[model samples]
Target chain A: MEKIKSIIEVKNLNKSFGSNHVLRDFSMEVVPGESLVILGKSGSGKSVLIKCIINLIVPDSGEIYVLGQNIRELDQDQMDKLRAEVGFLFQSNALYDSMTVRQNLEFPLRRHWTKEMRDLNAQSAVKEALEDVGLGHTIDMMPAELSGGMRKRIALARTLILKPKVILYDEPTTGLDPITAREISELMLQVQEKYKASSIIISHDMNCIRMTSDRVIMLIDGRNYISDTYENLQNVPDPKVREFFD
Target chain B: MIHLIKIDSEFLREVGEIARFTGRFFSEVIKPKQEWEEFINQCFWIGFKTLTLVGITAFIMGLVMTIQSRPTLLEFGAVSMLPAMVSVSLVREIAPVITALICAGKIGSGIGAELGSMRVTEQIDAMEVSGTNPFKYLVVSRVLASTLMVPLLSSLAIAISLYGGYLGVNIRGNVSWHLYWLQSFGALGYGDFIPSLIKTFFFGFAIGIVGCYKGYNSKKGTEGVGRSATSAVIVASLVVFIIDLIAVQVTDLLGLT
Candidate 1:
């Protein structure tokens, strides 16, 4: 096997809400260009782990290094700059409801790209991104106007527009029907192939996990219980791991 | 009395939270030094869109004040004083206070609901994780708009109110429109106008900050959104009255009264 670089790494990540202790000594890593899914039952602190990776919900006592810089050492400006290279796709699709698809895609460019760069490249960048999701024609439509599947696709497109090296998907397939879920799962694969961006998907959707994840980490009891390929983990005899499979 | 003297933890917690939130607002507000388009958009939504409701309420307030004061004035042979009295009260205290209260009900709740929805939907989180400053884009613009717009809206309401008072004066007597406008202006002085106008900026700040705080710190779920909206209006309206009380005392101290 060829050597793979760990693009993202977490060590002893401890986050607690009061005495609830959501993420305790949790640790994981994502290698470059691989799709890693953190599988947990709802409220198993999967979201917290991802949010901590992005420095959204700060972990109580642990370290996270994204790309190269330690997230805690980086100031707000640096964190924001780092965020541009790490795309977060919310489960709600969090598409700015007031904005159209084009405006939504253009939003990040306005913030990250200088005026001259945006003036020169924003139009084509937005169109190319939309086309990547097969929704180039829906650019002018409001987020409210799009169906759930389309909104999800557009959100992925918006995430891709930044050409992020790390894509974080929080339950990307939670609310979709079976068919839409499969489509989104397929889209995730296509995104991984096309952009070659590493991703950490926080979900329990078996189909999505099967289709997109190169590796799976089961977040159990605020800790990384098991880390393995899907085929290997499914065949394990441990009840905790097998519970998810059954 | 002993219980009242002892500070409640919840109240102290809220005060601390609000102070910290206020500090963050001022801190973020200075720079990267831009958000003009969002600011103008907020002003329209928070200021222009609120005109109709405020206008109607102000007009009716002036009309009622005049009508209510007439019979009492007649008893004292001061019927001619109706326009002056109505205009004075409307501009000095009633107009700003009433308009602010109405705005607290409308703008405060609207901000609470919208931001609450955004917070719950993770739109605010999306903005943050996407490397956008939600505070500058959302909080500061809305706060600045309210601080700037409430006074203008209050002044407009007062003018409409004075006209309503004129109609009220005409209902029972024969006060001409020109004479009514003259008396309306005649009754107001620097003492009456400046304090009322000044206090409204405080009122606007109170409303905007309270609404944003409630919404921004809202708990998870749809129920939390409802609580945020309700708590925003309640807190904003309560602060308006408190601000009015303090303003009155300060004006008295300054001999503006």
Candidate 2:
């Protein structure tokens, strides 16, 4: 296997809420154009880790280098610029309930471009994003009208609209049916291949771990146990690793 | 004693929450993107939807005030003072306060419930994770809508109230419609109109910010959404009266009357 350039590097990341230590000196890295899956139980700082990398929540003491830039140290405007290059899919698809699917896709695009700059040209981009996610026919439907799987697909369309360099998935398959989950995992691969972007997925689903990851990182008790290939992870003899799979 | 202490602590916590929520309004107001579309939507919801209710109430209010005051004026042989008194009371004190109270019941609860459900269902978290600024989109837009729209609604309500007052005068006797308006405006100077109008903006701001705050910070489930909606309406109503009282005292101290 060829080693690619590191697009993200984290060192000594620490975060806490009041007395609960969420992420304690956590650290890891993702190579450019590689797919990495983070495996952890709920409340183990998986979501916080993703948020900190994007500077949504500032870490207490740490360094997060995304695309070779220290994301933690950047100012708000600078951070916003950096954030535009990264896409995030939330556990619960956060489509605006009040808006139609088309409006949801257009929201991020219109926000990124001013009204005068956003004309007929951007409309095609929104349509293309909708088509990419297999949601072209559901453009006028509200999120409440869609099933869970369909909503997730629309959210993916919105995320891809920005053409992000890195895609972060937070529990992408948590509540989906097995078939839907499989399709989502497959779509993740498709997105990776199409965009040629680095991808990070946080999940407890072993099926998702096995299917979507090129490298697996186990997070147990606020620490990284191992970062290796899926086959290597399954063959390991660590009690914690065994327990996770069991 | 312990129970009393617990109650006090709970009250303080609620008060602190409301104050913190209101404080955030100032902070978010200075931020960018304005969320103009969302603001217009909120105006449509808060001002346009509630217009009929506010109008009816104001109209009845004017009718009742005029009718009640006419008899009292007649008893004192000062029947001409009816228009002046009703207009002064409505424009200066009654209209803004009543309109705000009604809005606190309607718009405040709506905002609180909407945002609270959104919070509980993880919609807000989704916005943040998606690299969208929820504060700018949700808080600023709603606040701007309330601040701008409430005044317009209040003006419409006052106008309706005056029409109702005209009807009240015509019921028992004849008063020229033109003279009735003249007398109404005769009593209202810029002193009454400007201060009263100025304070409605704050009233609107308070209602909007408090509703958004309560809903935005709602707890993890369905019950929390209800609590947020209830608290928002209660706190917003209290804020309206508090602002009205302060406005009255300040205006009196300034000798504007």
lDDT (C-alpha, whole model) for all candidates = 0.91, 0.86
What is the model-wide C-alpha lDDT for candidate 1? 0.91
Indicate which candidate wins on TM-score.
1
What stretches of model 2 exceed 4 Å from their correct place? A1-4, A114-117, B1-33, B68-80, B125-132
Fnat values, candidates in order: 0.73, 0.38
TM-score of chain B of each: 0.96, 0.95
What DockQ does candidate 1 have relative to the true complex? 0.78
Model 2 over residues A209-228: C-alpha lDDT tens digits? Answer: 89989999888888887889
* Candidate 2 structure quality by residue, lDDT tens digits, B8-126: 99989988877886677678778665777778888899889999999999999999988888888999998878888889988988888899989998989999999998888777876
Query: Alpha-carbon error at A134 in model 1, in Å?
Result: 1.7
Weakest lDDT window of 10 consecutive positions for candidate 1 chain B:
B1-10
- Winning candidate number (lDDT): 1
DockQ (model 2, Cα): 0.41
